[model samples]
Target: MTVAKLAAAPRTAVAPEPTGPVLSCAGLVKRFAQRTAVDGIGFQVDAGEIYGLLGPNGAGKTTTIKMVCGLLDADAGVVTIGGRPLAELSVRALVGYVPQDIALYPDLTARENLAFLGRLYGLRAGLLDERIAEALELTGLSDRDKDRVEAYSGGMKRRLNIAAGLLHHPKLLVLDEPTVGVDPQSRHAILERVQALGDSGMAVVYTTHYMEEADRVCDRVGIIDRGRLIAEGTKRQLVSRLGEKDRIDLVASGDLQALAASMRGVTGVESAAAAADRVHVVAADGRSVLPDLVEAAERSGATLTSVEVSEADLESVFLNLTGTALRE
Candidate 1:
């Protein structure tokens, strides 16, 4: 299906040249009564780029996005878009936000919902109609535009929610956990659409707990945890921070701690630990130490069901930095 490209904003007769990132947040800090939800987090998203905020729940991703959208005030920070401070009303219009929860009215048809939201953005009749049509087409929901939200599948509802965000032709799109719960197919569709949005020149900030999703869609990633941005860079850059270590995950049933301890003593093993039901071994060379790990598992009476070896990936990098898995 062909999605219509969003028309770029019209140039004035003598418009000022633009420079810097389309969206930038600096020293963002937020706190509740007694807890700091976000702490001095900062990053930038340029035009036509996808920046993923990779973190687990309670990692401060939501708080940071809320501050960027002006839904919540940051205890300290500055957010800017298109070289204009977010405090300016005009700059707010340049951002589109899609939250984790479905935000459409169940009784309204997708067309009706889009029209209603478009009007809130001051879109006139003709422009509103064009935007509704374009948003539906962009989200692959044109044929089903007349369907009521209550009658749509979870995926359809989610797409409609996104379509609502695009009604005003935002330059930067912030999506928070947009793929939380859905069939794999729907999740795939949502991810594909997000990537398409970036390719079409919209700067996108995607936040997710899924490491694989970040690897798939992000041009760069900022990893957040415990109210702080612990690391920020391209996947390659982040992985490179781990040096030459390789990650070996041994999925075996038995005394995993014992197996981990035994493997840790191997000459090439850098570190070993047991988490969940797996023994995670970091080594200078996983391939060279695989035989030792296998022998250790056997000696510990752990039946080896599977073994996965890989250099540092986003997941391994996260674990190394945070001392916890993303899924945890």
Candidate 2:
């Protein structure tokens, strides 16, 4: 598989503008034997929207993603792309999926791998070369296309895997943990390209357990846990819905209960509770009330070790709703 002359691609066929959501799923459920891997998961992703499925490992993010991509059958639910049910084989062509695992032949050069995969997507010889070149360029791998996959860095392979997914120019892209196990630099590069694609009117469903990744990249987020979608909204909307304010972690030795009591008495504090060696405080204004909390702690004979204050964010919202951390 070789492109002797990599010329500029001819005018690529652009997917038609979506009249409705690019992807929609309702009451999606999947079970493997006795365990239900996905339960009642539903969401919508519009053209140019990057919807993130945020959950920890085994939280059914991947299972839900598979169902959305039509790669796995759902036990119950309906998925529609562009107002058509997923049962239509032709509609499946509207989606490009990149699984968590790298899907590439180790011995094949980047160009060779893409050429082979493009053919599988039914791209003809002339259009195939153009698509491959465009995909490589989008993934920042144009210069390395001649190199074998075995010689590419983990990040490069990840990017190349993404490039292959884009070869046929699917309107909706589903990526499962695209940055997992990648170096920070490469992860940033991959994320940048995903953002670019979203900007170019491609709908994207991205799944990740990394809190910061979801926060940084997603236009809206669906928080899934125990195989259920607990919440879905923009970060701001989710946090606002939970009524979370600033969160402060007051760490001290002595009696944490006493520290918590003091914190609870602070005027701006919305709530305070003692968990282990720390006192968690929610306040309308954390910084403004920190001085008072410190004084109260000192008066209660609790020596303050450290104090951390952060405005309301997805982490706090997740903790409030699920009673656990997002990564856990």
Candidate 3:
């Protein structure tokens, strides 16, 4: 497929006024029985920017989105849109939400579904019709507007879901795992559309478990785990958090823990741990630390068939800070 045009006509015909943040959540918390699902998480999305919430399963991403959209009341904290508290009914109209699951009627045609949703947002006859057409075209589903939801592919359904959210031209769009289970082609298309939306100056809050997706699409990412934010920054800034340390991986057949213990005492090596068949080591300088690791392995009576060392990446940073894999 061809790359979607990054440079397009500006979103608004009129000049945009300088403004404050379009969306903000501060000290947000949610609880279910005995567990805290969202624990005082906070972030802001500026107008015309994309902010991604990234984490593994059960990380409270969905809960956070629900609170922001006013679908669920926060146990504590506040959500604001365009400087107005979310408790105001007017703020709800300014925010559009696209959930992970498909929310359209399976029996309705694409255009019909959009028109129905548009009406709910208070769009009337001629205006609703026009908005429906624009949303369908923007999502690349204009040609399939007459198709029934059940007849559409997973990706097509996802596009239509997004289109439904855009029916009223919301100032802020909240998307939760929008590309889950989609084909690579569809995934790329969805990502392109999201970028286009942000380029048009709509603030977006996107949540996903895919690290690469967040890295590629977001201007900045907030990493959440166990209902709390462990880290947040641009990919470069997050990786730079591990600047003083380098990572070394070793592949071996026997006694990995024993080998890790030996490597931990080597000069320049800060820490070492073994998981499965590999030993992961953190050091001040990987190049200066490799020889000592090799000699230590040999002394521990373990055969090290291969070794690799490189600058720390986002995954390593996550592991170092949380003691858990980002994908887990």
**lDDT for each candidate structure:** 0.85, 0.83, 0.83
Query: Could you tell me the lDDT of residue 189 within candidate 3?
Result: 91
TM-scores for candidates 1 onward, in order: 0.89, 0.82, 0.82
Report the lDDT tens digits of candidate 2 across residue range 1-328: 1111211223234333356999989999999999999989999999889999998789999999899888899999999987788898767767888989999999999999999988877788888988888788777789999999999999999999898888887878999999989999999988888887787778999999887888989999999998999999999998897564788888888887767767777898766766667777777788899999999898899988899998777766666566555542
Candidate 2 overall lDDT versus native? 0.83
- The TM-score, computed over Cα atoms with residue i paired to residue i, of candidate 3 is 0.82
By lDDT, the best candidate is 1
What candidate 3 gets wrong by more than 4 Å, as runs, is: 1-18, 247-310
Rank by lDDT (best first): 1, 3, 2
Total clashes for model 1: 0
Candidate 2: regions farther than 4 A off: 1-18, 249-306
Cα RMSD for predicted model 1: 3.0
Q: Name the regions of candidate 1 deviating beyond 4 angstroms.
A: 1-4, 7-18, 254-280, 291-303
**Which consecutive 10 residues in model 1 have the weakest lDDT in total?**
9-18
Q: Report clashes for each candidate as comma-separated counts.
A: 0, 0, 0
Higher lDDT: candidate 1 or 2?
1
